[model samples]
Target: MSAESDYVTLISSDGYSFVVQRSSACISAAIRRMLDPSLGFAESKTNTCRFENINGLVLEKVCEYFYYNEKHKNSKDVPDMDVPAELCLELLMAADYLNV
Candidate 1:
């Protein structure tokens, strides 16, 4: 894949855009499917994904989790990510939806 295809843009409901590594984002099965080239999804073509139900703040956390997951995939004693208590529910819902 070209350098351009190595990253993807994720847009949130509240109009935030995060440019993240495609491999990192693929930690979420749902996102992998959305950006699968063979699947021919519009998101795959554009390398952009829009989450209508997820706000910017939550989406930002999700993206962080993506990288965190990728970084720890082959390691032991991983550190826990800091999450605000207020975002727990929404993060849980987003995780379920994303099949992370």
Candidate 2:
């Protein structure tokens, strides 16, 4: 794949955009499907995904979790990710929707 295609852009509901490594983002099954080239989805063609129900703040944390998951995939002992209390519910809902 070309260097540009190695990354994907995730856009939040409120118009925020986050560019992350494709491999890291693919840790989420939903994302993996959305970006699959053979699927011929619009997201696959543009390498961009937009979450309608996920706001920018929540999506940012989701992206962080993606990287964290990728980094600790093979390790037994991993540090806990810091999550703000107020966002717990929203994050949980997003995680469920994303199937992360």
**Model 1 TM-score on a 0 to 1 scale:** 0.93
lDDT of each: 0.92, 0.92
Candidate 1: Cα lDDT at 69: 89
lDDT of 2 by residue, 3-90 (tens): 2398899999999999999999998899999999888788998899999999999999998998888889999999999999999999
| Collision count for each candidate, in order | 0, 0
Clashing pairs in 1: none
lDDT of 1 by residue, 17-70 (tens): 999999999889999999988888888888999999999999999999988888
Report the backbone clash tally of model 1.
0
